[model samples]
Target: MNQLKGVVSHHEREIAELRADRELAVAYLKAAMESLDDPDERAAGLLALRTVAEAHGGLGAVAAEAGISRESLYRSLSPKGNPTLKTLLAVLKTMGMRLSVEPEHQAHA
Candidate 1:
């Protein structure tokens, strides 16, 4: 494991940064949410929420507060995850956030 020494993982660093600043976490999540509409980038969006969940509270805590089992939370937030709208709303509500809709900037062709 010598090679693993002094290596801070992306997840760890991301969580730490999010936990340290609420505003940053909000911006981070907002940006991640934008990617949700793109199938090619959706995984990144889910993973981003997972990171914030890991930051705002431990997964277990967030899951419990969101009225879901920890295992469900983990599975739903996985890269290939497909969380239901109910679950997404629940998770966001638990984390003091919510979803909003806005018109895309691209003009209709």
Candidate 2:
């Protein structure tokens, strides 16, 4: 292995790692979902999900399993996209995960 320059870009390396690690995939998405709640970081959140989709499963396969067209999934997961709850659930389920609710930490007054 005699290489002077890195062959794969950082993003490609990240995607490869995510594909290999399901736990990592879940944690990454969990953090990303928080951003979805913030208006300013919504696009970044969507992009994060999109990246996981590309890693865990290709967009085409995920879309098919989720009962959506590939093109539609692409549009819905795009950076500017605002996905419906159904779409979000479908995507998560397709990725072998599900969303859950937990009590947020709040100070009792």
Candidate 3:
């Protein structure tokens, strides 16, 4: 049981490090947002932002870059958070990324 916990912790640490990369972080954020129509997935996207913030430079630094209070960022990024578009754009900008739109594929009805 202890070993399993250690392994999980180790993997989490690795993921945090990976999230620090700009490319990977962008991809992760995009994937999360793309799945946001589902409530559960939306929560997961918000959670992913928290992880990315931590990876980039912890919540404090990310919040500072986004010109928002750390507390607000924390609350807005929480699992049940509903951050506004402004907040989301600011955070993405702080991370040196931007939001882009792509047409969703559809089949003829």
lDDT of each: 0.92, 0.90, 0.82
Highest lDDT, which number? 1
**Quick one: how many clashes does candidate 1 have?**
0
Question: Model 3, 50-78: lDDT tens per residue?
Answer: 88777887889999989999999999999
Query: Cα-based RMSD of the predictions, in order?
Result: 1.9, 3.3, 2.7
Local accuracy of candidate 1 as per-residue lDDT tens digits, 1-109: 4687789998789899999998999999999999999999999999999999999888899999999999999999999999999899999998899999888879778
What is the Cα-based TM-score of model 1? 0.90
- For model 2 the local lDDT of residue 102 reads 67
TM-score-wise, the better of 1 and 3 is 1
Query: Candidate 2: where is the Cα deviation over 4 Å?
Result: 1-6, 105-109
Give the per-residue lDDT of model 2 (tens digit) for 1-109: 7876758977788889999999999999999988887899999899889999999768899999999999988999898898899999999999999998867668989
lDDT of 2: 0.90
Provide the lowest-lDDT 10-residue window in model 3.
Answer: 1-10
Candidates by TM-score, descending order: 1, 2, 3
Over 4 Å off, model 1: 3-7, 107-109
